[model samples]
Target: MQNIGKIVVVAAAALSLAACGQQAKTETAAPPSSAAPSSTAAPATQSKGRECTADDIKTTGKFGEVPTITIPDDCDPPKKLITKDLSEGTGEGAKAGQQLKMNYLLVTWSDKQKLDSSFDRGQTFDLQLGAGKVIPGWDQGLVGIKQGGRRLLIIPPDLAYGEGGNGMKPNETLVFVTDAVAVTAA
Candidate 1:
């Protein structure tokens, strides 16, 4: 009779311990898929935002009166921009006021020729991510990337310098090889 009682107590304790082990596993696993997860947590790559495709860009390539643009494949522009949270973004990153530091080189896809460049400087320019601080194409192009990563920004004139092109030239589409070096607030 005493042995039977001891067995019952041991069985209860073992069952409780097993339940605890299960709870631990559940707690540590990544939060359910839908939650935005934390900022530092790498954003899941499932969200597609407004960044234009080479096709969309090439199609919309002519803006205002700028020039026709052609972006190289090596540029790495997203076929479709995939958006996920960075520490902060206004609208999938397209909205105004988000600030970022980046390194880039501009090129033409038609001849795969280097058009203009910033990468050669090994410098990063600080600009508002979604803000009008930069051109609309840049504003629209950066819509869906996280901080500390690189993406190619291809700007058609409509999204670029546009019609008069800051007086540098008139209506020309632009292509950029952007390295999103860092992200910060406006």
Candidate 2:
């Protein structure tokens, strides 16, 4: 009879420990699918009170112009690069090693300062995608974009200039509004 009672107590303790382990997993573990940014991942439109996509962000100039941007005051920059399509294109999608002619407006994430504008220069910027001519964010963000599409890239520092900024500031997160004007085969 005493042996049976001891066995019951031991089983109960083991069950209690097992419950704790299950609880820990549920509380701290995210699904493997959500761990990395994928092309299919939905934009975190709910990140702040405002959406980070180009159309949702406040602009100062006329519609379709190279407008000044206003970032949400309460939101922190994302830890990973985020690509959101502001307007989808009907042309061929971009691929690695392809030459892309794009119009871009770059703004520093911290202060919303305009860093670069291809529109102001009155010419589309050309680069070979995934060929190291630009930051990793541009390479990755341009990969799946179609010609004539407008994309918004929210690039974390690591994907942009990293700890050493691109003559702007160190560890600066960059926001780019890019329009894929043309794509040529590699």
Candidate 3:
């Protein structure tokens, strides 16, 4: 039988490559799957009333639907990777080194064009958290999130495709809405 899970992983990889200029690498060659929390990480502070948060990202959408994201009026990208939990999960929180199964939508920050979405394939994308299997933004941003939770990630170019962009513009920030479907022990 066709593994929907594998299909999802390939879709995620292809989408990531299209959005960012990352060279293709096999999952086995990826770095270790765990990120140690850093003491110098950016501080998470509350913002202007209901919308005040460190990432400064806003969104509106329902489950299984594409979400619309709004950046600050100035449109300046965050310096660090920003992760905000959109919907809470009931399962155990994901840990570094675990394989995460998820559904995701990737979009370009400049034009807001969707680069990829697992929802289209009706499958769940899977990756080892903190491993080099994906970009630094994903490796770092997804840590500590619980399975079944939805999160928004705002990634800077350095963590994404860098100066040599993939299918996107150079040094452009990227946005993603990710749903954590499941987590497996490493």
Q: Against the hidden reference, what TM-scores do the models get?
A: 0.46, 0.66, 0.69
Poorly placed runs, candidate 1 (over 4 Å): 1-95, 109-112, 166-169
Predicted candidate 3 versus true structure: per-residue lDDT over 1-186, tens digit per residue: 111112223343444432222333221112211212223423334443342244566777755576776666444567678898898787778887899887777766666666656676576677777655666777778888787788888877677655422333455566878888887799
Best by lDDT: 3
lDDT of 2 at 5: 6
Mind giving the per-residue lDDT tens digits that candidate 2 earns over 96-176?
Answer: 888877776777776677755657756566666776545667777778888777777787766654443113345566677
* Model 1 error, position 149 (Å): 1.9
lDDT tens digits, residue span 92-134, model 1:
3323566666555554333445444334434445565543444
Rank order by lDDT, top first?
3, 2, 1
Each candidate structure's count of clashing pairs: 10, 0, 4
Clashing pairs in 2: none
Instruction: Flag clash pairs in model 1.
Output: 63-158, 65-171, 66-171, 66-172, 67-171, 67-172, 67-173, 70-109, 98-129, 137-159
Off by over 4 Å in 2: 1-64
lDDT for each candidate structure: 0.37, 0.55, 0.59
Instruction: TM-score winner between 1 and 2, please give it.
Output: 2
Question: What count of clashes does model 3 give?
Answer: 4
Q: Write the number of the candidate with greater lDDT, choosing between 2 and 3.
A: 3
